[model samples]
Target: MAHQLDKSVPIPLYYQLKELILNDIKDGTLQVGDAIPVEKELSAIYGISRTTVRQAVAELVQEGWLYRVKSKGTFVKAPKIEQSFIQALGSFNDQIRDLGMTPRTEVLELEVIDVPGFVSDKLNIPLGSKVIYLHRRRFADNEPIVMVKTYLPYNKCKFVIERDFVKESLYPVLGESLETQIRKIRRYIEAVESEKYDFDYLNMEKGKAVQRFISIGFNYRDEPIEYSIARYRGDKNSFEIIITAT
Candidate 1:
């Protein structure tokens, strides 16, 4: 195959080929879900070995730029949504919309339940205290991205049980209904194996990992207002933390 790929340059052939496909996708030459050229065709186009083409394609697949279907060729994939926590404290709806994607939320469960010991401690409430437990699955562009379980002191937050989470976000509701503003949020995150909720709500397969976030929101009075457990599909989401120098 005659090619214009610079063989005299020090850059590897496979990486160059990978960049070529990435540029094509960036410039709208390849739309999402469009199948990329086969290894043989790509090899011919680049005058590279089949192995080089395979390497480039495999890297793209691993990096979430492409996906492979058994008995079918590789296709372009939607990019992961970046969830920036530190840079902005926007609601999921606002954040997803800023990224040019539609945001949707489904309330899976909403009821008052006895607070478990762990949740009680987190909320600094009594162990036998009742809480408004709200479970939700959030989506971006109709794709399931996260499942969250939120616990709020029932005595104060019972109003939330009646609000329509599908058409609303909890944070805004809290600000409107509560007497004080949510002044701070403490969050802990870890990578953990997916559970039943992940498999059921997130469409994750067995053995897949999820990013678990435990967040405690505090009011202006320094009292805990909400404790939430959110699990995000690692492949569909990425967290970005911005660091600024003082």
Candidate 2:
């Protein structure tokens, strides 16, 4: 049953209506991908003006709880997956599995290539040095979540080029293969317009927003061991950072 607007309270009518919609979603009256009633219908049901309904819906849309289709209607958007890896360093598969979601990976490209200038800078390697370039797309419960391109010094990580990344996590493999374990990571996060690789590998639309994660991994010796760029779909991913008083 739909909630009735309580005019006796001091709360704004639009906010009350928005809360009702959220309640419906929480109670399973509305599900992800379900279309919400139009402004006219909501206005009529709530005995409010269309302007009021618009305000409530617009706020929900802005907050990522809803989305508008050009000619179709408004819909309850799927809740974004929380990227726990951002909060702590761990295997992606293990982190996702802890969230009760199955994780899968697809190795797209694995080759030994001369380090690009950008990779050279990040890894602190010579420009012409060989690096093991690995490209992969990661999925959670069959939905594509991120596409990562990683570069590691060939002399230390050449064995990685032959390993099956689809069945293994890179960090663990690196720890076992190399003399040192990854102890620190420095990351820069930015929002960027989606490009061709996103379209092809991530099934993202051209010009859609993407969250780019640029990270450099250092070993116990403080030597830069890996440089990676991961692009996550903005609509499907959310990050959480925890700060504690130490």
Judged by whole-model lDDT over C-alpha atoms, candidate 1 comes out at 0.88
Worst 10 residues of 1 by lDDT: 176-185
* Best model number under lDDT: 2
Q: Residue 232 deviation, candidate 1, in Å?
A: 1.1
TM-score of candidate 1 to 2 decimals: 0.91
Candidate 1, residues 190-227, lDDT tens digits: the string is 99998897888899998988999988888878899999
Clash numbers, per candidate: 0, 0
* Whole-model Cα lDDT of every candidate shown, in order: 0.88, 0.89
Model 1 clashing residue pairs (backbone): none
| Candidate 1 C-alpha error for residue 242, in Å | 1.3
